[model samples]
Target: MTIFLGGRSRADTGNVISMDRFRSGRSVSPIRQAEAYWSALRRHGDVPNRSDIDPRGLENILEYTFILERIAPGVARFRLAGNHLSRIVGMEVRGMPMTALFSAMARAEAAATLEHIFLAPAIAELSLISGTNSRAVSQVEARAILLPLKNDLGEISRALGVLVADGPLGAGGLRFDIAGSNLRKLDIRPDRSPAEPVPGLAEDQAPIRRNAPGLRVVSRED
Candidate 1:
């Protein structure tokens, strides 16, 4: 993959690989490829809708691609997820909240990020580290990118994202350590001015609810 960042092209690393793994023989992270697909669909000024996404265009990175639908303030469920994601979590993850993949302490931050993605309608890139449950030995470093997407009703209530780890995820529960994140508003354009509306609720606030559904593992054949 040839990475073209900062208006320059770097050496082509391999058939399929992310810029982050320039030298590693590991499979491509898919974040970059996914971003390209999203950008291409953004021919109009508005965020692309779930229907705009073409799975075949994402063939190479399809295993790491996913679709999220917002269910409430600061909350989203996996409407569709790929095999690569299921591998990381050790089971089928459809219908699960995005935060279910994060460590206990990092879940609050994850929720905040999700809210930001919808309200601010921004793009989020996160750095993550994961470790095994029993030994606590750090296992892998990962990267994720969330791009805003509009639902069929034209509300920014959906997002397209890709997440990948540097190494294999072995058995047992694996939770990510939130390292850092970067968020960029989708409306930022040098030729235009800020126009998106501010969210009614506070940035860190989560909606109150009773008996929120928990994530469960289910079997599925691809």
Candidate 2:
């Protein structure tokens, strides 16, 4: 498997951290953990307004979750997730344009990742750092990813993101897992779309059933 990591010790090799570790280190998959998050939404018997989600829950998931915004035409409200592969951080991010979260280069990197997600009809993962405000770089490190969520129109609508604050230094393994669930919840927009994302990026070229859970890819003409 392709290795995605922060600063890991050799012991971390072959030792992937599962989602069950949020409280105590346990073996769990991102999707399974998201199952708990979705149950929270189910409890509300509604989409659980962003305001309703507890900040603690968001932070817990964020430690090993994925999230994103749909502010733009192809994005989500503020930040959202598959509920299986990610968790929420501070919705303090509400109303804040994604660009405001990072530097010029960081913004460009974020945009490029977003563009790839749009083009491929798939998800894109990456690590993030808050700002240099912290004298210790490790204190502000945040690893995250951008995932696409679609509306009824068969076009991208909302986005799913996962964020984890890596203290002085992050972990050496993937904290969460990605599977069939996000395959449907996330997509990579082809470079050629109404939004005119960055060009020449190849993305997820598979068809997914959005109304239900679990994801399976079906090849489609690009």
Candidate 3:
């Protein structure tokens, strides 16, 4: 990924991994990808019925963050420019809303993408920074799509979005850590809730003793 933010400056960034990963139904944290596929199926102003959604597609749309809580219309939070994020802007956001993930300037950009997924209206892309506080800023890429959910009466209900980030995906694997290596991960909840799970492990395997539905465990590729 290459980003030319203010015009004169350009930066090399992460890849938008192929949509092939969307086919992995057994995989965890594929919510975003699944949502995109749903939106695609109902391309003519039509929304895919959740039942009509392929198992693989369905798996890709559930964010580990939301799955663990089993909450709909929830929020995912993160630091916009922490060492882990390694952006020009540096800040800590342990429990901030996912909306805090971008700057005001970037919000419109980010929102446009999210709305497509949340509102089931569009597709968007992003080039973000990694390394929360490490001073090592690496560019990452994100591609997302949104799909709409309809109720029994055909009223639109929920919106599903698929998100892909390519690059130094994580800043660490443990929860509530201040500084660490960046890797691909799902933080499990927007509140940084006391119920938060260990970063890289499945709820079933994580050392913590939680009896929730068991959120998926996503592994970072070596």
The best candidate by lDDT is: 1
**Stretches of candidate 3 above 4 Å error?**
1-36, 39-45, 50-97, 112-120, 125-137, 151-153, 170-222
**lDDT per residue as tens, model 3, 1-222:** 222222223222233333333333323235444544654776344655544644454442333212101013433333111233222123444344445544444444443333334343222233243323323334443333334455456544444433444444434221111111111211112233357667878456557656556676668972
Question: Against the unseen true structure, what C-alpha lDDT does each candidate score?
Answer: 0.74, 0.42, 0.36
lDDT of 2: 0.42
C-alpha lDDT (0 to 100) for residue 19 of candidate 2: 27
lDDT ranking of the models: 1, 2, 3
Ranking of all candidate structures by their TM-score, best first: 1, 2, 3
TM-score of each: 0.70, 0.41, 0.36
Clashes of 2: 31
Write down the RMSD of all candidates, one decimal each: 20.5, 18.4, 23.7
In angstroms, give how far residue 222 of model 1 lies from its true place: 83
Per-residue C-alpha lDDT of model 2 across residues 51-84, encoded as one tens digit per residue: 3345466555554443454556333345533332
